[model samples]
Target: MIPSLKNILIVCLLLAALPACKPKTAGPLPPQIDYGQDTCDACGMVIDQPRFAAATLLVNGEYLKFDDVGEMLAYHMNHPEAQVAAWFVHDYLSEEWILGETTKFVKSPTIQTPMAGGIVAFADQAQAEAFAAERNGKLFTLDEMRAQVHMVEHP
Candidate 1:
């Protein structure tokens, strides 16, 4: 026998009230990173080896990372059109690192720029550009950036 109209309505209401059978989100959004070895996927250079990776990890609100700063410099040097970018670093403090999963892949990187006619290193992009624009200087080339690294800083 067919169920009564009240029962059908109740069943419909219950189904409606229940959470839609939508699939649960799988996990945290995947970071735009290459957890691979310390190498720039774009240029195939060892990351963070020659220089610390410095790039805009958040570009237009999107997560990003460079394998290292050298690569970021190289990329911008090669392509001056990049508006913003990101870089990845190993997370020694993460629990995942303890589990052997490694938190080295990047979700985003802090943005920075070169400074002082390539003489000084500024911690922010605006400073670098201001110095460059005001002084009639240009951004450091990848070679220049590499050459400026002090042995004390790396060692």
Candidate 2:
């Protein structure tokens, strides 16, 4: 039997709404920070330096901005139970947001970060190595930075 016109329109409308019912997937990119206006979620300091900015994306889609990479590490370390969807950091040279897991890190006392964290991120390993060598800094991976922060907090 053929459906009535009203029933056919209802079916068409339901089909049109189906896509909107699908679960929304979060994007892999990090959220933009309002530099000089956005305050760090950890230290409450203004995030004026794009090169030194860091952020954590929670599973709930909350973006926690930080003034320094070390501050981001420390925040996560303290909130060990927080569900983190992703971590992001700005490339020291380009000031572009990069996946923290794929970025290289350098830590040195003389690096002079915003919060004196002395941590900077690089999108290129060779560049990170060169920066480390030039400033007597040590190279680290994302896990190493987290571990370093954990040690400092726990000890």
Candidate 3:
């Protein structure tokens, strides 16, 4: 038997509302790394330090984990063809994940990161500034970090 018009309308409304019922997501999320077990995609070193850990989310939904923030930048520099969606780094103080683009970075030999990357991320600019001042490091934005990677790798 054919459905009534009222029943069909009800079904249609429910279908329309189904999408809204699902939880909203803020786009693609970074992957969780199993420290000491997970290895850096670029350097092939075990990612044991949360404060120095970094990751890149590619457009294809692949996560490239890194032992150091500088390694992540170097990966992108070498693989310029990579289609990156987002970057994630751990705040040095909190060891919490933060968007790399919006985060501030400090670079210095004194930082003592894995693979001698010497770069650390911070969610707060003030905190980064303080860290840089204490370590005699230079503050860098994401773009500047990319350029700095070249120098580190080449030199």
In terms of TM-score, the best-performing candidate is: 3
lDDT of 2 at 109: 93
Q: Tell me which residue pairs clash in candidate 3.
A: none
Q: Relative to the unseen true structure, what is the C-alpha lDDT of residue 17 in candidate 3, on a scale of 0 to 100?
A: 92
Q: Please report the TM-score between candidate 2 and the true structure.
A: 0.79
Q: Write the per-residue lDDT of candidate 3 for residues 1-155, one digit (tens) a residue.
A: 99999999999999999999999888668789999899888767789989999999998888899998988898788887888999999999999999988999999999898878899999999999999999999999998888888633432
TM-scores for all predictions: 0.31, 0.79, 0.82
lDDT of 3: 0.89
lDDT of 1 by residue, 1-155 (tens): 98999999999999997887777873333243334454553445444422233334335655434444444444555544554433333222221111101211211123332211123233344655665666565555334453544322110
Query: Between 1 and 3, whose lDDT is larger?
Result: 3
lDDT of 2 by residue, 1-155 (tens): 98999999999999999999999975687888988899988778899989999999899888899998988888787887777999999999999999999999999999998877899999999999999999999999998888776422422
lDDT of each: 0.39, 0.89, 0.89
